[model samples]
Target chain A: MEDQKPTSILVLDDEPIVCKRLKSALEKRGYEVEIFFRSSDAFKRITERNFDIVITDLKMEGLDGMAFLTEVKKRSPATEVIVITGFATMETAKESFQKGVFDFLAKPFKLGEIQDAVERAEKKIKGNIS
Target chain B: MRILVALDTNRYSQYVVNEVAKLAMNTWADVTLLGVESRKPASNGTQPPRNLPIVRKLQEFREEFLGYFKDESVSPYAIKRWGYELVDRGKGLLEEMCVCKGMKDFRVRIRFGQPTKQILTEAVEEQSDLIVVGCSKGEQCTWEQDRNAPEKIVKAAPCSVLVVKEEKKPTKIVCCLDHDSVSQESLELINQMVTLHQTDLALVGLTESEHLREEVDQKMKQILQYYTAQKIKAWVSVVDVSLLDKFIADTAEKGLIALWMGHKSLIGKFFSQDRVGKLVRSAQSSVLILR
Candidate 1:
């Protein structure tokens, strides 16, 4: 507690309920969480500060999630971003990799799956794995 | 939920922080401590000059400071230096309040600009679920005559805003429901906060006259039925417009006031935004406005 740095997560999804449920779940697991239902707001946040991990949904109204991934990687290359979407395709997944996504999870995925991806990202942050 | 707790230099500011810590402990919510640094000089001009230390330090380490940044562009280095100092000062203040045991894993954000604008931008950036702004009882008189920044932020906030008026151990939450605008989504939120606070939930419906009593009655009954089935012990009441102030005051003595966000017209003909604003200002207890 005295020396360890806190890991913070930012979740961006158009669905308010998705942000809400994910936030509560992550917080309960001893992770700091922030949620944005809009990409524009998320972009502002990314400019102001950096988060340890970012979980974003691909399909959105304005400033699509794929564009967000690009912007985030450009701003902070080391920051890990995971893509989650209902409509997943090889093309989108390949593009996400090209933009530097840590992991890609499909929509209707379980909280357990997110936690697993986050754990892997945490290991990467700790320099335990690449 | 990701919650942002904004602090000021007010006497009661720490109380707000402590109360929020207690809330996080119960609900498993992480908090972001935000402090705004205004360029304006202190009103009383009693404190020591702020530029002394940084300027004096720069003089002593002029060679080292210049050497470190010698390779960087002159323009960007100067901007980073100033921004770093300001942000560092803001972090010092926020860190003082993060001493609580529950705040061990908190995040600090320091913004140098207008308080409302900074807060709104941070809230939007964080996509925060709640923004908890603290106000003292003594400052109410001054803010009542004019719409304060907190009031303005509440109106335009993209998420729910909780205005904690003073230090009060809330025993119940008086949820003011607009019969015309009540929806399942809002009710679900009301349920979450009520559960988070571990406080009793009471629904109060405002009506102007008996002409629409039957309609109001049916709506109240439906709300009660839904909440009851959810296993939440809830109560409902119908009150006239004239008695709203008294009802609010009575509730404030031992509980918080919960209201939903909606267009002013959707709040039934009897209630108005002005009255809601007044309720937030004058309430002795904290007010949680759900969006």
Candidate 2:
């Protein structure tokens, strides 16, 4: 496991507990993970570093998920983003797709579901690499 | 069913025509090739060029185009027709074809609209099950600007919308989920679409917390079960942001990627914008963004 190249992921959410939980879960799976509680901070880190996938929450205090997604696309054109929101609506879903989101997830989610999403991301990333 | 392949003589339009024709042939549906002549009226409003001449020329081109299909042994059973009227003429032709073809299951109409409103109205009126549209090639346009056709169609259409890129195929389908309730509906829809298309399915998730990993895994199991019941093959992968691009590049290599529209996570939102947009604009494969 150590010899294998660890896949890296970035998780951005306003909740500290959510970040911590995600970081721990991903690290257990042999992924190098980073967490950010604010969209601005997350954007700063994203600009400075390259990540394979970015998971962000839709609604936040300062910079919402939609605005952050715009910035991420501007900064890293190749990174795949999966959006999670507590407020899910048909309009928001359509808007997210129009904006070109990779996937959409609503809040109060299951851990297993997130794992499936990561599995897909890892497969996609590895496929590109090899 | 009546299938309309509307043409404006653009390269992408030609491609769409070919694809629609192929679909029509396979489905054994009646096909109509209609070309809309968007000629500006004479400055003095002289008898705006007789419809006969324009129709004749368009008919000739249509025959020539269809001739290739005939040579390939896919006769369209009908000749191509054109008219000078814009939406009204197009709609009339469509309705006429529907009745003439004795269509009972489905009817397809393809025409260039003012982009948004006209197309949306036509789609609603026809009660279409699916609308196939071409994305503008080599142009910079925002979703908010100038009646963005693809965006508007996806949002306003009562049914599914497939935004076709030039020479694109729907082969690889990627479902982005957040292990949430909303994603369940999106997953079901993705499963149905992928199965119908006989495409490969990939489930993607982002891991933000250690506690959630088990939950993510359980959800993956459920998805696997769903696909298994449908006799559809699928693979699931979980990655954090660091590995997202590599995942996309890999899955896209096979064909197109289909993503669920509303997954509400920070990463989900990011994927919606940067990753999905990049793929749609430049990825070698086509993308289906489902809402």
Candidate 3:
């Protein structure tokens, strides 16, 4: 029998404060969390390994969130992606869902919102495995 | 940021609370839920009874407020250890209820007196950045207890005031200001509004003359750059100060209208105090008076 591995999460936001806060909050919840301030850098890392969950901001300097999430889904269909944005619009939300995003959150969201979203995503992953 | 929420025993207050909750969730603002229990002429200077109906209503408001953050797993503010301690202050017995989760300050204060005066006093004492209050929908925004409470608060509050006409979300936000002196906090508040409603933003610049129009254009550009960088669906347009009133009247019917009425604001100079109050009363949509 093998010991269960902890869930892995990757967080990307251009704002360092957002990344830093989410990193600290998510890590305290006993998950393996990695953060990136640049979507391009996050893209590079995602290419290197697959993560169970990816949390991203929709608007960024390069490789915008939509494109990144599209790639994530293409590479690993089972991975859950949550989209957080300061600029939330109906079209973007519809598009994100169309890209198979697991959840969408607006900026200034309470830490609890992201926590709840991740927990739900975790349950789905576990359910699929079992 | 400090937000003073004026709640009464009405469904409108719930709309106000829900709106504020959406904002506070994002900003982590120090939130003060204020309820005023109007005193009878005979009971002017006495301690309010513990079982006053307003006290019970305030408790319900507190619970409805905290309910928005119940799913919050990161802070102790989410804990259900709610307690409020009332204190006497000679002039008006104020019940100060403290609910803390480390850094955030979420408290309830029950004031005794006129609703408008109590809300204004609390805004001054707390030095609140914004006051959130709701009014019934119609050509005249009314409160159940006081017919003119919302109008009075919007007119007299020392800080910014948000008059929520109803709980309905606006399709867009029209932010009107003449200069770039808009504070970062105001911009952040607009950001929170846009996010909560998932709406578009329209920046309207006001100018009186051709020379000032150029400056207004520059300022609008700077503001637009800020919102565009944030990735908000925002656009800009210039409106003459002469036509500002008409612009506001027309736009208010379409979406939420925010006016920068800070001391440095030229828009503040253009809109008289009564006009500001009237606008809040007559506007078909919610209004945010940014100070």
Residue B262 of model 1 has an lDDT of: 51
Model 1, A1-130: lDDT tens digits are 5227668899999778779988998998888899999999999999999988999988777899999999988888778998876444445655776677876665434466578778878877877422
Best by lDDT: 3
Candidate 3 has a DockQ of 0.08
Question: How well is each residue in B21-40 modelled by candidate 1, as lDDT tens digits?
Answer: 55543333445777666664
Model 3 collision count = 1
Q: Model 1 segments beyond 4 Å from truth?
A: A1-130, B40-105, B138-147, B182-189, B211-222, B263-271
Give the TM-scores of the predictions, in the order they appear.
0.53, 0.45, 0.61
CAPRI tier of model 3: incorrect
Pitting candidate 2 against candidate 3, the one with the higher DockQ is: 3
Q: In candidate 3, how many Å is residue B245 off?
A: 4.6
Backbone collision count in every prediction?
0, 75, 1
Tens digits of per-residue lDDT, candidate 3, B133-223, equal: 9877666755756777888887677667898877777888998876556665577678877876778999987767634555667877888
Over the stretch A1-130, how does candidate 2's per-residue lDDT look in tens digits? 5328677788998767678888898889888899998888888897798787888887676888888887787787677777766444445555665666665655444455466668776776677767
lDDT of each: 0.66, 0.56, 0.77
Docking class of 2: incorrect
10 residues in a row with least lDDT, candidate 1 chain A: A85-94
How does model 2 score on DockQ?
0.01
